[model samples]
Target: MLTFKVLAALLDYPNAETVAAIPEMRAILKAEGVDAPVLLLERLERGDLLDCQAEWVDLFDRTRAGSLHLFEHVHGDSRDRGQAMVDLAGLYGRHGLTVQASELPDYLPAFLEFLSLLPEAEARNLLGEAVHVVEALAERVGRRNAEYGLLLAIVAGLAEGPAKPVRLATGDMDEDIDAAWAEAEVRFGAGAALSGC
Candidate 1:
């Protein structure tokens, strides 16, 4: 009973050559025990794989659409990139995802993993703020949430890359848990505050 929607707006048919070259991707799906026809139809109808693939695509679309409207409000200038990141982070937060200080090292990588799956613009918009918030909170938490942090780090790393040259570090803090809580608060507030864009 995994009910989901495949919006026609995102549909795209794969060419034969492209499909032929994706045996590895297909094999992975098979290894995961997905029904081939269901997977194909789901991907075909949604323009991407299930799991994070479809979610990222949808988030990208929403971010892009929101950016367009935001530009109008600012006389055609781009909105604050940080705000876009906040918006994206808010989306993930709503799904019960957030980075913790103790788990910074591991979580950072996960965050980058998820970013890699996204379009450059979408990844930049969403993950850039997420890293900042995560790092900031990590400094306060003293220790990160090992499980959640690892999950986020893996997902983020998959989307983007390692946070090395980027130096996305969470600094020292008096209260690490508070920092993480604040990050979640920001995300929740943004989710509630954002209007039609």
Candidate 2:
């Protein structure tokens, strides 16, 4: 659904087009039964984008609190995380979905795109597997009153079952971002590869 695309776009770095996209996103969310936030559109309409973009970077790009990467929340930098990435990317490939080199299969946005390709029941079941991560992210981002939090909540709502949270270790506060960036890329079967953060 276009709502998945819109939600995915909301996680990306903001630009002029992002502000212009607000109405379409809000309308699509409404049509999809998501009670979209009006405050976000109001801020964008008032051209408070500088502040919004700054908050986006501070909340997501800088901190691990709302990382869009699913494995980062579930597995950290452990060896298991690498294996999970490979497995997930392979799952996408097996289903004939070609993930871009720049996007991780476990990335929530990419995952949402994959969900859009699945039948409703399958999509809901798959989403249920990661509902905890979405719920935790929603809670964290909602505390800051970020509109992006609503997207997470909407995703969590789509999945079946209780909103149980997955326990995770605190990430290394002193960890190097560039170093983390240099970690091995996730390689799917048949020579596909994606270098994602």
Candidate 3:
């Protein structure tokens, strides 16, 4: 059985006051003949539960390379589950993106669209705060043009409802858009551009 202390620590519970409350956790680990507490501590020390800090570093690098498509997928799927939005925002912050109230209107759509994938209650709780930060960032960056504008519009539509129509460009603008975004990333930083979305 897993030790209550181990499970509590893994879950970041306030305190593993007693081992009795986590009987099921203990039983499951015990049944598996696992030394739950030791394993948990080892994983924690090794940052395994943190899912490889280097992975996140690689993710950040890919994001800078403009190759990280997971965020786009997550943004697409975030209908009400705010966790994805929160995670993305945290990543942005970690990468030194400045999220502020002024930037909210521009970036809020994307943030909200992500939150939308979460439960309504979670979305409701997260939307306001997330929007506030996004707005602040937008204000810092000023207004958006075609590329950023379109991205924001897409995010906004998704947040408001599913299957919202978006008018994205087709054909030859891909290279131009990529170049523009890359230049912007170099100038403003990837986190800022992402938050601007």
Candidate 4:
């Protein structure tokens, strides 16, 4: 549904394009009866473009705690994450979605976009697999009082069952956490290492 796309857009890096889409996103959220994402949309609408972009970078780009990559929370920087990336890419392919080389399949915005193309029940069912990631991220972002948390809560709310509990590593410095969960490039196809698979 467009609601998923709107949520994805809100989660992505803000730019002039994102700002231009606010009215339509607001309308889509209202039409879908999803009220929470509208708060994020409204915040985006009110904030200065550069300030919004800077906040997004500070929260998502600079901190592992607010990362948009799903596997960052699930598998950290382990080799298994590479295989998971390949598998998720294959999943998208099966559904007729071609992920651009610039974006990882597990990136939250890309995943949400993938969901936007599916039947509502199928989308929610598929989202169930990542509910824990969404919930954990929501909790972390909410602790900072970020409006982005509302968007994640909306996603978590759409899942069919309770989220599995997640345990985040504690007592680590920010740089240490970033170093530990740092992202690695994912390659596809034969001789591509299957990402160490």
Candidate 5:
């Protein structure tokens, strides 16, 4: 639905395009009866774009807890996460949605976009499968930014059912936040040392 698309855009990093679209986004959300993000849209519209961008980076990019990648919370760098991403990407492809090379299929915004293309019941059912991740993200993000948390809460509400309780711990002071948030390198076909075997 358009509501999900609007919510997805709001969840993404704030940019000039998104900032400029605030009035239209607000209208879509209101028209869809999704009012949780109205205040967020108002704040974004009134705030400096640079400052809004900085806030988005601080919340989503700087910490594992606030990651926009849903699998980061679900699989946490495990090998399973890679396979899960592949499966999710395949799902998107089957549904005629092509994810960008730079964007993971499981990214929350992308996932929301996918939902926007599906029938309401099916969309809610799919979202329900990831409701725990959405709820966890809401808790983590809300703890730091209530507006974002509300957005995610609205997302979870659109799911088919309530999410189960999931406790996600925050990082410790001794942890290396940068390393924790670093992107893993993608390697081509064969192992570099395969000649030695």
Candidate 6:
């Protein structure tokens, strides 16, 4: 599904390749009834490639609130998270999706790519696994007043079940982005390690 590809592109680090592909992706997403992503597409469209790349790094790479890796939201870098990664990678292999080492299996772009390989029902089923995480991230990104949150909401919308219950209090997470920027750059891990994860 091109909508999946569009989501993947938006979640990836934006660059000349990503910027150049925006128009066609926009058309595809619109045809797929995905209007929410257009907000992000518009941001990219208005900027030149460099500006878009900067925005991507600012919004995603630099902040936990807008992190693109799905597991970072839930698992962090705990052994559990690593195991989940291994299992997810195995699942992808079963489906014929090979992920490179540099790209974590839980990365949203890669996850969306995996979804693109499945039937809609199966895709929705798989997406349901991260509905709560997506919901929380959507709320966080929305608080930033960046329309990119809508893309996360769109991911949650793809799930089939009722909204998943979340124990984490996302309402009090006002400093997540600021806090993320303060910490040294650490990669994924559970608990406190998540700030950099």
TM-scores for every candidate against the unseen true structure: 0.25, 0.77, 0.22, 0.84, 0.84, 0.82
For model 1, where is the 10-residue window of minimal lDDT? 1-10
lDDT of each: 0.35, 0.75, 0.36, 0.82, 0.83, 0.75
Q: Who is ahead in TM-score, 2 or 4?
A: 4
Per-residue C-alpha lDDT of model 1 across residues 1-197, encoded as one tens digit per residue: 00000111111223443344345444543564433334443443445334434443332223222111221212222355446545545655765676554432122334444444545567655554444344333232213323223323322332233343332222233235224423233435555667434
Clashes of 6: 4
Q: Candidate 4 has which clashing residue pairs, if any?
A: none
Tens digits of per-residue lDDT for model 2, 90-130: 88988998879887788887898788778768877888998
As a TM-score, model 3 comes out at 0.22
The 10-residue segment with the lowest total lDDT in model 6: 168-177
Candidate 4 segments exceeding 4 Å error: 166-197
Q: Which one wins on lDDT?
A: 5
Can you give the lDDT of residue 73 in candidate 4? 80
Question: In candidate 4, where is summed lDDT lowest over 10 consecutive residues?
Answer: 166-175
Instruction: List model 4 lDDT by residue over 62-93, tens digit each.
Output: 78988889987888777988999999999999
TM-score of 1: 0.25
Better of 2 and 5 by lDDT: 5
lDDT of 3 by residue, 43-159 (tens): 334444335334333322232222223233223234523565466667556545645654322233334434434554555454343332222222222232232222223222222
Where does candidate 1 stray beyond 4 Å? 1-144, 164-170, 174-197
* Cα lDDT tens digits for candidate 6, 56-121: 677777776677777776765457778888999999999977899788898888998889888988
lDDT of 1 at 77: 29
